[model samples]
Target: MGALTPEVMVRSLSQVLSFILAIALVLALLEGYVYLLFFRRPRALLGAIFTRTVQSAIAALMLLLFLRFLDRMGLIADLVAALGLAPLLTLPERVWAAWSALSPMPWRLLLPFFLILALELLIYFAGEPRPSRLGLAYVLILPALIGISFLIIIPFLFEVRLAFSNMAMYTAQNPEFGLRYGIENFIKVFTGPVAKDATFFEVFGRTVLWTAINVFFHVTGGLILALLLNRPMRLRGLYRTILILPWAVPSTITAMAWRNEFDFRYGLFNILLRNVQQFFTDLAAQAQSLPLIYDLLAWLSQAIHPVPWRQDPTWAFISVVMTNVWLGIPFMMVVILGGLQSISQEYYEAAEIDGASKWQQFRHITLPLLRPVLVPATILGTVWTFNRFEVIYLVTQGGPQEKTDILVSSLYKAIFQFYRYGFSAAFALVIFFILLLWSIFYLRITKGLRGVYE
Candidate 1:
């Protein structure tokens, strides 16, 4: 009744159609450029590169244009309306009427169809399909490449576009929002008022610290447990099950449970500490000779109040890290355990004959052998912990005054809470570059991807 009036929708549809036709026109020009490059010039290495680039670019443009055309064409809507699909079938007549009213964009859809048809005809008259291995590969691979391009590359391009534009919530709701491209969003991320207080650098450092601490503990704890479990011992299965139970539980539930346990007053942790303090007090009082124990207990109990784990910044950070480490270890433990089982016992036996101690055997044989498996697992764990949002959010909500806010959580706040889409997108791109650079550096340093040959 309000904004669903036919006139408004028709205008919006007109604008959308105009946008599509414009894109189609551009694609047609690019296709013509491709034809000129290959058909007119004798084939050369430089020309081949140019031709390939133009072809790929034009193909991507056509695919995106086709999708937008189909969406605006209301093909899905028409099919659903005809078939009376579930949920749509149960909708009231007024809803259906409104949908039908809003769906189509007049005869403008014919523009793209005719433009494409003309391009195909031109190509058909100019040349026939050649049967080459390269052509065959293109036929097989182009669909998958196009799918990935649409799924990943296009959205990434959109994010980059959004980063450059002033596309906040206001502009987001308005389809005719004008493009205002500048480095303003990037500027704000680094030097704005938001950056002045708790700078992006600080958040980034804390994030690095968070990732380092969590991964260190996860890798070490998991490796230790994995080693223990890998040994031939009785009740190893039971120990493994009990150790891995923390990871078996969902992270949200685990975070909530840990949050309660970390509570300051009458929480499980404090209660247990109080009981331990009481036990020590009783024991020291009964043994009158060791009065230091009684005095120590009195002083300790009086001095150490219940920790405000979630309310204090340092403790809040520690709380989430602890919860994450617990959640993360079991996965690494399983990975390292598998690596350990795959190692030949003959290596250890030979080491034993060479008078190598257990530590020597582990240092020489175990670690070297486990490196191949652990390297990629470590990288995956590092990336996951770097971007982990759930534990941080659910545990402390990035508080005691945003002290624990990592990049991803900060991005969530900027975009969802503050509606600063452009700024958040810029911030996200910075994070992406940081991670990308680090990953490249890490892979180069480790050379983990070396093939079986030199």
Candidate 2:
């Protein structure tokens, strides 16, 4: 390209100044609109416009000074050349380029600021009276809802788009590659070849089973502990503290420790089994004269072998469940304990006056009262256990040939291990819908929320 002439430089600088002045003019108009329509202060509107004009003029001057330095250093032309825009650039385009190079104010921030101001103004003008606290709170909350849309809802929409598009590693690297939008990924999740061995249906079933079993144990164990702790007993606080320690301990550490203990050889469980086997063998030798006793003893010796806790599929599933139960029970206990505390003592006292047994009191008063608390807690526990990846992974690593792989862990493997981004996105959405529908169904069936609200 030929060198930038003095004429081109002068033309570009004038365009830049014109663009900045146009922005200042827009801001003056906006300030007048806000002051008159919102503030209803026509007398102060000119002052506001003047203040904004001065600020914009100062900003424009500073931006021009910075652009001049870049122009003098020949950086602007170099940047245009590097970006392959040199041949296409007009004087106005070059001016805009210089403005953009300095990363002038982003619309993301300014748009929200203006939007919030507009909302406040609308609320202010809605009624003859000044806006109430509730109106102001709603106006303030508008930005936060926008923030949630960006943070959560936007990524979800992106995932949904990926689910429909062919977004594998190849497409990720090749921008020119056309994304075929279809339900092919979703189909692949069901009856495709990959689904034959560890099908989505199978994994989903296992996930439900895992959740049901864990939640069952968590509630039962936690309820038992909470009941014991709620009684008037010695060192009750100490007992509660000690029982809660398992939960306070980091889950990863607890999982690892349990994994070691479940080892087939030289582990605590196996070592104890071996000791029991040795005792049986000794007892059989001593009972040789009593033929029937010796036979029973010999059978007992054979039955006392070390369990393969992690290597076998069923055993590994059980091992992960055990670890998760340990980690989960404490949370259930705390939640149930809180519910127990909220129950009225008068109900129990009335039951006792009626000569109701302890079981009757618990059955009629405690369980009914605790339902409001436990129902929601149980739902949350079920969902958490459904997605419980750490304990399962840390303990069993979804081992025994992926027999223990839950839906979440399986999707994780699809993304990281297989690099099947589109497939994983589809899988994730499937899981999301399943959980969503399940939650809706559960809440509808229980109608337990009505009691809480009442």
Compute each candidate's TM-score over C-alphas.
Answer: 0.70, 0.72
RMSD of each: 12.0, 12.4
**Tens digit per residue, CA lDDT, model 2, 25-111:** 445444533333333321355544654554465456445654454444333544656777443444444766676675556553355
Off by over 4 Å in 2: 1-135, 175-181, 193-197, 448-454
Candidate 2 structure lDDT: 0.74
Pairs with steric clashes in candidate 1? none
The lDDT values for all models are 0.74, 0.74
Candidate 1 error regions (>4 Å): 1-64, 67-143, 174-181, 193-197, 284-289, 449-454
Highest-scoring model, TM-score:
2
Worst 10 residues of 1 by lDDT: 173-182
